[model samples]
Target: MRLATFEHLGLRRSGIVDLGGDGDDGAVLSPFPEGTDLLEVIRTGHVPATGAALPLAEVRLLPPVEPPSVRDFVTFEEHVEGVRRSVDGTAGVPDAWYDAPTFYFANPCAMVGAHDDVPVPPGCHALDFELEVAAVVGREGRDLSPERARDHIFGYTIFNDWSARDLQSREMQVGLGPCKGKDGATTLGPWLVTADELEPYRDADGLLRLALTAEVNGVEIGRDLLSNMSWTFEELVAYASRGARVRPGDVLGSGTCGNGGCLAELWGRRGDQDPPALRPGDTVTLTVEGIGTVSNTIVPGTTPVPIPSARKRPRARP
Candidate 1:
């Protein structure tokens, strides 16, 4: 079943999307209640259709859940290698990357809906988008083993990790961040597809053999198979849960895919003449085979607030 949150009749509600309903564009059914918290529904695991079904076209979709936390992992070796080459002129991935699934915490408060407008962050020129898949945690777990991690996942959603590449490059030079470079905006939606709905696409090896693709304006930029990940979602979740608790509504991203997931990777491979960075008015759309698509348009950013610059302090005598 696909779960979603949408605005209908000037009120926010949670419901199940019925793609084959009597309406011309299907309908949204099983609405929990007006102002219902979707995250709480995921925790209880009970979704009842107590309200009337609304025509899908009449409702504006929102991010399915307001995730409490988001952990995005770099699980694709090709992506890592390409990005490293672009940033460091190196073609090989770090040895540590192969040892474990490395990740970074993203700002949940910065999330936007599937079709919302994303602003190009202030002081950023090299804007980019990462095509990724994210799993939403349904059950709470701590120090989980990879084998037992699958049960904790509730559903999947397409993730667009919007980036400010120029800012990212400058910040990482000091060895510690992608913070402001990435926190500007992140996209999560279309809807959340329950894990069981995707069982048909799951291979015997436990990899979800879903096809993923990205496009800008109307041209296809990159495509890849979800099976190409170096590590599984289970492993990523286990790693995230190590010594910490993963609760319902927490999100775990499958990172950027290879074969052109982002413009940075494309730039690294073909140089700057080809695919250009995202600009205001450009639209980015990402499609995951079974889960669906999330598209957002770029808009101009707000002017930044002025701040005092830091200065060096004199050394004290020992």
Candidate 2:
């Protein structure tokens, strides 16, 4: 089932995506409460079959899972190599990178839904987007074995790990990791498709069956088969929990994968490229094979304008 968190009639809710409907006709029933988002649903370990009514197309889609408890390793090799090539002139994944699956924390408060206008923070001129696949944990357990990893997975979603490359490059040089660069804006979903529903897309050859793509302002920038990933989702999960607990709603991002995955891969150097970093008018669209598209527009920030004092106002005409 493809589940989602959405806003309808000014109230937040949750439900399964009804692909059969033109607008409101096909949404399957799910009983969700007011302001119930994906984070709440996943935490409960279940999704009911009824909810308040709304046209699926009319409602705005939020990240499939909000404020996930844990986010695990980024295991895509092409992504690592790409970053290394751009930053360190190295073309191979480091031995340390392979020693264990690496993980990073993404800001839950900054998570945004499809079609939402993302705020481009001031002084950040090198905003970039990363196309990735993220999985949510369904059950909780510690030191999970590879054979048991699949049992812990609940669903998958399209993720855009929006980045400030300039900041990222600066921080990584100090070996402190990606703190400010990665947490800016993490995008997920049109919906979260359950693992059981993706049976047809799961292959036995250690490759994901989905075809992924990314476009900026209607221009295609990234495209690749999920099969290109050097590491499998199962491997990522097993490695991540080697000696730790992996809980429900723990999101495992696939990291950026292959050519055109990020600005660094698309353009060799920062200023060497012609097009400016993502601007206010830009629209980013990320689409997965079975699942639909997740899109967001960049907009001006909401800094309050200064109000003139009453003393500066002219006296009202009597």
Candidate 3:
């Protein structure tokens, strides 16, 4: 079943989406009460589709859930190799990356809906979009083994980790995770597909073989398979739960796919001549097979506030 949080007649509500025969002319069946928190419903694990059904086209889709926390992992070897140069001026994947799934905490409050407008961060020029998938945690668990991680996942959704490459590169120089460059915005919507719904797409090795694609302003820019990840979602989740906890409403992203997932990777591989950076008015769309598409239009950002640098202080006697 596909669950969604949408707005209709100026009221935000949670419902179940029915994608008809062609997967376009669908309807939303309201199960929970109006103004109900979708994250709470996911945590309670009870969804009853017994209310009125409204045309999907008539309502505006919102981010399925307001996640408590978001951890984005880089498990795509090809993607790591492609963007290393642009990120840290390196040409190869670091050895430490192979030892475990590396991830960074993203600001959950910065999430936007599928069709929302994303503003390029102030002082940013090289805005990029990352085509990826995200797993939504449903059950609480700590120090879980890889084999038991799947049971804790509630569903999956398309994730677009919008980035400011120029800003990211500068921050990475200090050997720390990205901050303002990434906190600007992250897209997560269309709808959430239950974990069981994707069982058919799982390969023999238990890895999802979903196809992912990204486009900029109606032009195709990136394409890759989810099965190409160096570490499976279970492994990523398991690694994440190591000495920590993963609770309901927490999101875990699969990072960016390889072979044109972002313009930074393209620039690193094909030179900075083609695949231009994102600008205001340009729309970025990411689609994942068996899930759905989430697109956002770029908009101008507010001017950054000025901050004074620290001044040197005289040494004090011990």
lDDT of 1 by residue, 222-296 (tens): 999999998888888999999999999999999999998998887787656258888899999899998888889
Best by TM-score: 3
CA lDDT, every prediction? 0.88, 0.74, 0.88
Instruction: Rank all candidate structures by their lDDT, best first, as comma-separated numbers.
Output: 3, 1, 2
Question: Could you tell me how far off, in angstroms, the CA of residue 206 lies in candidate 3 after the best superposition?
Answer: 1.5
TM-score attained by model 2:
0.85
Worst 10 residues of 1 by lDDT: 21-30
Write the number of the candidate with greater TM-score, choosing between 2 and 3. 3
Q: Which residue segments of model 1 deviate by more than 4 Å?
A: 21-24, 27-30
Candidate 3 structure quality by residue, lDDT tens digits, 248-290 = 9999999999998888888888767268899999999888999
Error of 3 at 267 (Å): 0.8
Residue-level error in angstroms, candidate 1, position 71 = 0.3
RMSD of each: 1.8, 9.2, 1.4
Give candidate 3 regions above 4 Å deviation: 27-31, 315-318
State the displacement of the C-alpha of residue 231, model 3, in Å, after optimal TM-score superposition.
Answer: 1.0
Screening candidate 3 with a backbone cut-off below 3 angstroms (N, C-alpha, C), the clashing residue pairs are none
